[model samples]
Target: MNPLVITVNVKSTVYCDFQLRWYPWDDPHCFLNLKVTNVPSFGLLVDGTSTVTMRPELLEEYEVVECRLQETPHPTNNLTLLVHLTRRYQYHLWTTFLPTSLLAAIGYGTLLLPLEAFAERGSMSLTTLLMFIALYTETNSSLPSTAYLKHIDVWFVFSLIFLTLVINVHLMTFLADSESAGQSVRPTPSRHLTHVSAPPFAKRVRDRMAVPKRILRMSTVLFALVFIIFTLVYFLAIV
Candidate 1:
């Protein structure tokens, strides 16, 4: 019979497995067994970094063993060799997480801009979103496909959602400002000039925006708090 061979895939860069097995034909009085005397690093690039553990032995059923014994006129049994491994993806923090965090910061900066600078804020938000999309696409392309999401996946998804909400805030603020500006446009009424005459146009506009501006500021704070809480919970859960 041919020797047993096992191959593993390291595409995930998260974990790997190795299996080794052999069969022995002997009398019932004699036994065949395997043991782990020493485990080398397996020639991995990141040797000693990955966590490795073995599974309990799994023996073949009695029926199968008996059949093999009778058919071959010898004693034989089957066994399994299994191992589990885990690895941390520290590299992604710089390559993926850092850039994503910066993108999120850029999105938040747009909120501080004045509502009158609609074009500037809108462009900033859109640009941040586009750059985030490109970064996400590039990162995912190199990862192996899996049914379940990875830790980095969660990070990217949350970042995208945050950016989308920022963009929405910009849109809503612009609309509110535009509506207020339109309503404020009225013919000046002739009246005796006084020290307390109607405030300058800029001050009047600013006064009208007090509520919306407060609401926008509160929304920014709320977004930040939510993001911080989410990140804490997510990291704790993952760890």
Candidate 2:
């Protein structure tokens, strides 16, 4: 009997260039182009490198052998790679993405509050706004402070400030309208009958009717002016 010669591929190595592309709102997707090389123990006829491209659609098929951020260090310019390895991506999702979503939900909660709950509106609005600011600050602490605003940070601040202003406006409008309504319906004291005798029904009717209509008109104008002025001032500061 002749001894059998068994041939086996001992080592397989893969080199891939990954490109991560995503919209501003959505989680990023990665595409990989791999050059798969097969090494054999003994010299064989079939030995070559094959190029394989893997996209997000095909990620489920292959087990990610090794995924890491390839950092190229330079003395002059330190370039940080924002690569997301599959295992480590969850950290960003939880810390950055989920929290931002939660904050926006909290802001929307203010709208559901009853208009009569003036104190609750004021407190909730301010509290949520401050919480947004604190969260944004904490998130940015890990990054460098630069002049240009980041997209997430800008979105957070805009939503927060808008909610805050809206709550404040609602409070002010409720108060002003309440006061105007009260004045419009106020009963006037009669000059005669100092001891407070109920006048005849006709007299009462006449007195009520005599209340100047101009006062109601004036109140409407005043309320509109106040609201306009307040809005102008508030937005001027924000912008």
Candidate 3:
């Protein structure tokens, strides 16, 4: 019977002399068993074509291992291959994922504010959204200029736009409610009601129309329209 022997090799910048053997009968699925004696780094580069140095003694220990042919070349060579395993990839994790998630949380702040406070609280949403935009810009500045959008950038921009629209819509709703109430009652009647005893229903109506509804409604509508048009133009410009 011919003795089953397998050769193993290590290819690296730092000396990584290793040997591998296959034990086909031990594990049916994975017959290859890799072992190294003198190498410092256990990580091996498995690029398709290379003469890898192997210690003969380690191969002799495991006699029945099956060796599989190389499928594809390693995507990158030398130290470039090692970069994939390093902590550098963590930048992608923190920059893109963390800020986008934080922005989404900040967006919920708008919902917490009373709808009546939309006039004053509207700035909070816009400010938070702008803060995210600034963060997105800063994060992007650090990244390499690539044609395709990064995952985090996409999420941040989407959240920014979404929150902007949400704030605008709330403002518009408040303005419309205010304006309708204002138009329903005349200013002359409102002035006279202050002197005479106003009906309970009239008092409620006056309270509701305390805000300058007509001007605000027109302003809100115009703001939304301009914002929408600008957003569309900006998106087109970016694309």
Ranking according to TM-score, highest score first:
1, 3, 2
TM-score of decoy 2: 0.41
Q: On a 0 to 100 scale, what is the lDDT of residue 64 in model 1?
A: 17
lDDT-sorted candidate list, best first: 1, 3, 2
Per-model TM-score, in order, reads 0.61, 0.41, 0.45
lDDT tens string, model 3, 25-48?
Answer: 112222223444444443445555
Clashes of 2: 0
Tens-digit lDDT track for model 2 on 93-200? Answer: 678767765665565565555545657756776777788778878877874344555444555555566556655555564665566556545777777756655568
Candidate with the greatest lDDT versus the true structure:
1
Q: Report how far residue 175 has shifted in candidate 3, in Å.
A: 2.0
> Residue 80 in candidate 2 has what lDDT?
23
What C-alpha lDDT values do all the predictions have? 0.63, 0.49, 0.51
After best superposition, candidate 1 residue 43: deviation in angstroms?
A: 30
